[model samples]
Target: MAWIFALTIDPVAADSADADFADTFAVIDPAAPALSVGELSTQRGDGIFESIGVVDGHAQEVTAHLERLAHSARICDLPAPHLGQWRQAVEMAAAASGPGESVIKLILSRGVEHGPAPTAWVTVATASDFTAVRRDGIRVVTLDRGYALDVPARAPWLLLGAKTLSYAVNMAAIREAKRRGADDAIFTTSDGFVLEAPTASLILRRGDTFVTPAPNGGILHGTTQLSLFAHLEQRGYATAYETVPVADLSTADAAWLVSSVRLAAPITAVDRAAMPVDAELTASINEYLLSPRD
Candidate 1:
């Protein structure tokens, strides 16, 4: 069963510090109408969110996800979330999950136009089964993101690094990829540089080193990528972040699209070119990702 909680109190105010958060949030039916008709999250997609992967009822990497949420709030100019309160809310949401995998989303929306404060909520739902996608892998197409590699530094207003609700382009890219007979997409720069996937971070392997695009270039820093990189480093694998060239994709020994809920789905092909899939390494990565982590 799915669960939803509406945050009734201001999530960031200092006065709410000692207040009972149990009462601060109220359970709501997932099927019920909740947000105002004029809510900016729906009207303008003016919000930030984080989808945390929950395995076996434990919300993985809560602190990392919360920190990223705060980072997005800063980037989007949304109100900073109270970490303690949000942490409690995550605990509450995680408890609602049954056995197997689930997803808990933390959303902070700019409240109704000219309203009092920001609107916030937590939702928990069972995640889709990605077992086949993880094992069988996915075919990916390269779509130009229509920006030069230096756009983030040149245009800070783009808000590309923030995980906002404005995902129309991302979704559209995926649809376009499907239209081209592929499962997903890896966004590239207009000047021929590899960026990331529509919904996941791109990790490429060459020999013993694993590399991903530097997050400084308008890419939303991925929590799952970070954890997997750390796990790789611990397992004696070298990892680095660099500005990957588009031509390098074809030469990559292996590649995968890594995300919070989907975990890691190896890329079977890139633009109709068959790319090697490291099945043993892919399975090991997913095993580590599915393990309980704080």
Candidate 2:
């Protein structure tokens, strides 16, 4: 959280598409040639990955990071990567990446030597800029479903906590939002419980406390959102978990679409309704980020 500021992916990068990293690397997808990791194979299936923030040449929250890495691997049943070398992979990509502050992504596919596997994978992605909806605030639309409010309580066997690469559904929602003249889709369950954004967490503020749909709402344990909450708690802002509906989101005093990339991005509009993007909430987030990290 201390690593973020405003509704931005920090500073923008010089270019996004062909952004370079400090180190020589392999851009591997099953459809193309991948960097050789000592014959790790490139013929098998798919895998899952993460995209973490890189600030001042350091990966923010490295501990929660590795845990996420493992979480994804477990989700897809891929073998765990070598810790030391894999971490260096992130550092290598960060160093070799393009100009200005950046966010990095690492794609790790389960290449070759397998029976029944995922098609391919991306381990991580890092870049300074994010595909946020706007500059001042975001314009989001409510999704068709509600938060899976019973994930933890009802279906403990589900991949509720895992980060999966099967993102076609989420991608479709973004397109749908665009069709509706909105930025991104906020997914919910059928019963209408607000869960998360296209790729971020939904953080809404009540009177004083910042509330988010509980993890049981069927949201991934957002690395950025949680880390930011840690900092906010230290700053005396109570962060509570609650079941939020789209109607409630449209009326919050302040709200932001948060994630590891865009630290605390404000949401100016939810669907067609306009809402206030509280200055105090923004200030609190900035103060939290610019402060200090544990």
Candidate 3:
């Protein structure tokens, strides 16, 4: 399928005469060159981003996603985003994308080397076909993240909790899992505590209690996970953030890899070890997740 890609740039960042606006917002062609050769984001991967799910012309959880983006920018020492401008940009892209399920990415990168300002843009594109994967579930494998659980607190320079543009290692980890014949990879500390998935958060259910690794352990605070937990709590399910051992996957009644795009995907197997699949629970959680909430 030919994906529809559109870029909405902040008008203040571009010369007024060089840009065009749709509803007072410019949507640039993806094929057009948009960045400088020395853009630090492309050069050294210095930036932060947010991928938000767009459903029926609405950006899901906009406030949470934007807040997290700001937090990440702070960690990277990048200038704070102009939220009004960003909202307009996102609105521009979402309007152009025409309400079909899509992924709206808000990106902020340090501009060209030694440049005075940052580069910001919004892109709306087709979301991946995770429907089948979400319904059928996936198999995952655990891999060592090499960092100890306490590294975030001790070595803040690592920017462990920030969602930076530097995701090559994350991409490679998933590729490694695919090479091993698994659908996804769950990262664990060398000391044996389950952290999170390459691009998602981990959730393990033992009976009625749902547990995941504490965010203080150097993992990004998952926006989807947080929302789902609120719904689960309202539905009378328990949730916790605790140190999860790798072995907990085997003992848990169910496990899920949750994220913005994938939502709640149940893990069918861990390290090729099969687990009980609760079609009922999966359906219920997904129903609640997909339902509109004010």
| Candidate No. with top TM-score | 1
Model 1: pairs clashing at backbone N, Cα or C within 3 Å: none
lDDT of 2 by residue, 206-262 (tens): 776888888766578787778888877886889988877767886788888877666
Alpha-carbon RMSD, candidate 1: 1.6
Q: What are the per-residue Cα lDDT tens digits for candidate 3 across 1-294?
A: 224666745435322343334444566787688788988888999988999887766777778888898899788888776555666677666676665577888888887798877777777777777778778999999999998888889999999999999999999999999999999999999888989998999988888988889998889999989998998898899999998888888999998998887788999999999978888888888777666542
CA lDDT of each candidate?
0.90, 0.61, 0.82
Checking candidate 3 for backbone clashes, the offending pairs are none
State, as a TM-score between 0 and 1, how close model 1 is to the true structure: 0.96
List the candidate 3 regions with Cα displacement exceeding 4 Å.
1-5, 11-25
Best by lDDT: 1
RMSD of each: 1.6, 9.1, 3.6
Instruction: Using TM-score, rank the candidates from best to worst.
Output: 1, 3, 2
- For model 1, residues 118-234, the per-residue Cα lDDT tens digits are 998888888899999999999999999999999999998999899999999999999999999999999999999999998899999999999999987899999999999999999
TM-score for candidate 2: 0.74
Per-candidate TM-score against the hidden true structure: 0.96, 0.74, 0.92
**Cα-based lDDT at residue 36, candidate 2:** 42
